[model samples]
Target: MPVTDITTDAENLTMTLVADVAAPVDRLWRAFTQPAQLERFWGPPGWPATFTRFDFTPGGRAQYAMSSPQGEKSRGTWEFIAIDEGRSFEVLDAFADENGEPMEQFPAMRMLFSFETTENGSRLTNVTYFTSAEGLEQVIAMGAIEGSRLAMGQLDAVVQDLRAYAQGQGTRVELLDDTHVRITRFIDGPRELVWRAHHETELLKKWMLGPDGWTMTVAEPATDVGGTFRYAWEQEGAPETAFGFEGELLQLDAPRREVTTERMSGVEGPGTVNDLQLYEEDGATLLTLLIEYPDKETRDTVLATGMADGMEDSYARLEAEVLSK
Candidate 1:
């Protein structure tokens, strides 16, 4: 019960997820069959989904769009193949285009979800069977396992939250994101402490690294508007590597925010401006960073290369630094 079990058959390319809810079979079935109820927790944590057409009968189709917490949206459709009231349901699932048309690149798969009543409550199991090994492999390669786990975890939380709300608990984090991630966290520390962690050479050594086996050789920051800042890292027993940025400090509000317009070398063709804003909040500080690229292709490439995770990790490190000090 409570998503306490999951099994995957790599050979058969099938995944089975089981969850137990304290609600009765009828109530659970309603949560599954009702479009409004389904939309409340159909997506991974942080994503708010909306269903367009949900006609539960066999041969009917259900179309929906899930909007990520960060604003990216994806569409999908499910054609109901079989439905046994309060027992089981099967569907053909596939991705849909922005205009709600099914996409050719995404293959349709069969999904069966079953609801069984028990003395404790209800057991819900979802079985996904792919059409071909290639299809299964493609889904697996796209991190489906982790995504499913995240979604299921969210579902569990949603169930508990719903139960609590029914018994009179207040609001909760109803929205979630499945893609297009950006990390914006507030740190509970002094502004000077936060600034020192980011600008100090000793702390920079603990974070920014050029490459494997490389070490930071230079980190110099001038505390003025027309000041200069340089950072260079080199590997042991190898030629030195460096990246330089020269710019004018457009604005420096001290202990609060700083803005700089600089021409960065070795990263595109120069004339790149990075805007970094810092503000005091909740007895600490909040930092927002926006790096403007010359073109959309570069931005897309950066996202594909795991920029979200990297930035999140960097912020986590920043948080640790602030706490440690």
Candidate 2:
């Protein structure tokens, strides 16, 4: 289960799980709808299981007995409410006592599983709907959160294995058009040090700019409104290393916050509009850089070149250098 979107409202708890399996939707559906396939990865890992019965159809029931590591046995049941071949299925689940009776008057949960096909593979989503707040609370008290997470982890493993078996290949990273990347570092230094490392030329040279072999030519700062600055970098044994911007200091509110826009150019780009913002938090500073390109193609191209990773590494180095001082 991918567990993509999870939310809780004033009255109900909803969770959506997504998975991209190697096999088609029909195969994936069978694996979920068949009792034998589900028992393989249904329970928490390392727990002794005794699945008393399983009937996969509308109005059917599934009963399972599981024993913890400490030898405590627990039982549960799912009443199948609806079924859709190769598309979706819904069930109402609850805990059962020793006599196979529901102990608590909890709400009936409806879990719907849907499958869709993509060029790369299949997309499977599991949407779970809780009836009421009290029903959601009752499951939480029974440690449902952790249990559900463990179940999803198991499901992911199963999907990975099935995909590998079906495709006769290993897992591959699929990059989508709309992928967002952000990095954050916690620096144990004065907020001023971190702030200056980005804004001041002298301080930037100490950390932001690379070592001596790397020549940082420009050191211009416009501290007021409409002020412009640019810095050029060149490495000794490498091609002319250059990435700078010609932009205005839209706002400079001191050590607390600052915002700037720059039109960057060089090896990485012909030109890109960049916006940077800084915020102070708990004696530390949080810096955010937002790059806006002319189009999605440009953004995807930049991302493919690992620019985000490079930026993250540079910021990590800056954090270490600032704290060392």
Candidate 3:
């Protein structure tokens, strides 16, 4: 999984996404080409996609439907223009009817997908071009940016599972105690990369926030004993709801371990001391997070906030944007 970037350009009538997935180029290419895997993560979180037709050669076509929980379905098609196996492809994209025909009422566009190998994994650069600025605005106004983010977020889990199977181990998370939780994961990088991501403001902003619609408005990191840092965020449309976490560095052992006491604002709770341990494991980094709450009740309360899923998403994004970099 990489940091999924979704942005639109009004002047150029283009939408682009640049992601770094911590998987081999061949694996990602296969996932895109194979109908079965493609359907698993082709749509946003709540919608599951089904491909009725898939042709993988140049000048081929793909037709699929994304069905929502309410039983409503959205159909789409891709008319492949050119293809270079395991490298890149270009296609014409348009809304389609359930019967495999274009929906003339909807807009159509062109998309180009390219893959480049990185030091640790692969990078995908996807650019969608619209025929006119009005067409671009039509899709964007219809929630294209949000939908693209949700769809790409789904890709993180799929690629991570594939990598875990090949690694001989999977990520483990546990409730170690009534007032503590533990998370251990095999990060596909050296310990230094993971450590830098945790300690640097620039790297933290890349993937630290749990999901889309939130931006890191403030980031100040000082990884020294007794030093303090402030990290804050604001929702896309809710400035009044902006919140953050401020903490003091209690212990600092570069690339290995860190200890801190943090107070989270914008949410209810007292300060908690956290300890993180990182080490090399089978050519990868194994990160262990020990969370300590002020009381058992607070720990239970925090757990009920769906923090586990948020943390999982963060770690996956860390791989996509930070570790692979």
Candidate 4:
């Protein structure tokens, strides 16, 4: 286990766990902040976690559930209280219901995670503060210490696997559920630049072109909530083969996340909801797009269009044509 020490103080009503990770602070931070990576080891060996929602900014909330082999589920919620980017963060952790609301019978705890460079690599100091000594004892009696140790023990494999989440892996797609799909691409650029490339007309025109023979004709982009945008692309010298998309921004959190409704230009009825999130670590950014379709048919139909391959082409162009320059 990576956890070197586990201690409790009844007088202060706190429990502290110190772990030494064999990776840089930035890598460790990414493993925790990114939902794709966090889910791998958030729970103990048999119980695996799935994060339904992860908003890493202050005042935001994360909801997750750990499922056991016996089909029992333990739900939890994290209300982000404070964040010092790359260094530390604090959250109100509580046992939650199926809907992710905190349960009245369980007491909430304030947990602080601090990261720092160490001789071997980095150190993680996790401190849980309870309202009373009884609360602390209650958590310990529930096997909190053992569960945490086993969970952290699995961290070594995750952080060392650079090939999984690093740049140059191209676009990856995962079917999250019947109506949800997630796509991820690691960009060799900062978060701000990546976000700007998707919004600024000039930058978008340069790299948003999917294939070598295509050109972007319309590059209108929406950077504000409720604003509409349109984009069209055509093969070189073939205007008749042109296609376009139109969308209205639903939410915008600059340099972090955005949500929009997307559909083919002039199409009516339902459309897909796209949630785009960006996280930067060690000068590189991970761009995650979570798409929610109207149904499984629409989701599968879209994937069958070679969308993942096209996204990879565009992302490669983004690094070479926009970020490199």
Candidate 5:
């Protein structure tokens, strides 16, 4: 729990959050400035954030969305108002619609983020100023304070050394809820190349084969939102051992993030929504896939089939065959 205090001033129409982080001031600053790092902790727990556009300069803007386990998305925007290099910054924050435009029904606020060194590590001061007391009350009623605390509680993981934290860890899966699972793998490659490996048919065909005996037969990838992608695999020397998945692309942000609806080739009804994100730091990329299944039974059935091990095998091949060279 990094947060020390969360206070509200009704008269001033402001809310302040103070936290002590066990990281250097510079490291703390980097976590806030970098979109990848910020995304890791910007949303509370099961509702993870994805930043599609981030411009870290005065007069610039950022657009992001927090997705709930049930596939509900709450969008937000930030307009950079001022900056003091690595020490502090200010922005106008507001709720946004699906198109990234601010929603007039929700209250907008001015936020100031200040960083300073402390004896143990660093201190972060986040103050949000609302236009009116009712505006502040409205946000508070929406669970802003508790949500912010839970969100900041995750900052410690972001500030630590990425390689030290995840390099040796194989494909790891964590059940976020009954229907959502988050899978992560650290790839020893830059973000762009990793993204290319996922999007390019030639590159994907070389390494996406799950196990040694399997081979990719189809690799038609979706090129735009609403477009569908198909992939199939067959066992070597065994044509009958064929399986595939097809999905429609929902969102795309090159070299960073994409969301798709995945389903087995023949099976229909409803399928999982796969949200893939790539974040790079110090020449290494962390790939995260958040999969939303229709029910717990479906999630369990998929995981019970040794999915993590299969993913690990594919990721290892990806590094050895495509990224290493």
Candidate 6:
């Protein structure tokens, strides 16, 4: 059900195609604007496209060519007219020569692209308008309708991958210093909810426990400046191996930044300093955690505890159980 509807009006000299895609407006818009992504889906099933230029702005230009299996190449160009960031845009599309020069005899048309949010996801609309009915008939007779439908159908899977990568389905770990590890990820939730998940006892308990078989029994989060915070979790039916973190709040700013001094549940050495920063991007939260260890050995110990996997699991649970609500 990629291409939901295709309406062709010979009298009005217009053809509109619609697709209900399972992606956010921003993500789908990027796929439509970015050169690397447009190359993946701008052509039909057998013919793959190669984008040579992509300037998604007013008075900009996008040039690409589709190469068929038998070494045949078809070039095209789009002269952008208007753009509304992540919402909509208008362009004049036409056939082009190998050097991206527009061909005079080809059917040149103005096309409007819109990405609108819907109950299920985003609804994408592509409307092509010609100056005269005869011009519309010329393109329609060339199988433009079926070709456009096939081209748009390839967008679903690429959009899904882009969505997942943005939501921390991939790893993003960087080392700032010898004794520090920084992890950044985009959580599929609002900034306020993600901030609350880190400070509220009940909300923290829903996702902070390492894996599925463990539970956080005691979570006392002192969210005020200079307050002491404590948390505890243990494997089910094995209370002897409980573990968590106790820390003191160094700074407090709701839904934005927080700094704390934390010690592992029962480590024999020094504690770590954690600086958590949250930023809102297009209605989602970007979380950055800076963990500082007193020594390189301590940092290595923390990383060896499967820290990345556990953190990813917790964030996944937070998205599904807390934020999605």
Report the alpha-carbon TM-score of model 2 versus the true structure. Answer: 0.45
Supply candidate 4's per-residue lDDT for 231: 96
TM-score, every prediction? 0.51, 0.45, 0.52, 0.59, 0.76, 0.50
What is the per-residue lDDT of model 5 for residues 43-114, given as tens digits with 9 covering 90 to 100?
A: 986567889999999999999999864467989999999999989999999999999999999877999999
lDDT of each: 0.64, 0.58, 0.77, 0.86, 0.91, 0.80
Cα lDDT tens digits, model 6, 1-325, are 4799999887787899999888788888988888867876788643557788888779999999876423468999999999988899999999999789899998689999999998877989999999988888888898888888877876764677534546644446666557767677778778988988988888988888767899998999986787998899899999988877898887665776677889976777689878776756557876767677899888887798888888888888888889988
Could you give candidate 2's per-residue lDDT for residues 129-198 as a string of tens digits?
A: 8877677666667866656555554454344443232222211222222432222344445567777777
* Candidate 1, pairs of clashing residues: 2-20, 46-175, 46-176, 46-177, 47-176, 47-177
lDDT of 6 at 172: 62
lDDT, candidate 1, equals: 0.64
Best by lDDT: 5
Error of 2 at 234 (Å): 61
- lDDT (Cα) of model 4: 0.86
Per-residue accuracy of model 3 over 207-284 as CA lDDT, tens digit each: 878766777888898667889988998888899878889988876658766777788855565788777766564467
* Candidate 2 stretches greater than 4 Å from native: 11-13, 156-325
The local distance difference test score of model 6 is 0.80
**What TM-score number comes out for model 4?**
0.59
Candidate 2's displacement at residue 193, Å, is 65
Best-first order by TM-score: 5, 4, 3, 1, 6, 2
**TM-score for model 5?**
0.76
Cα deviation in Å at residue 54, candidate 4? Answer: 16
Rank the models by lDDT, top first. 5, 4, 6, 3, 1, 2
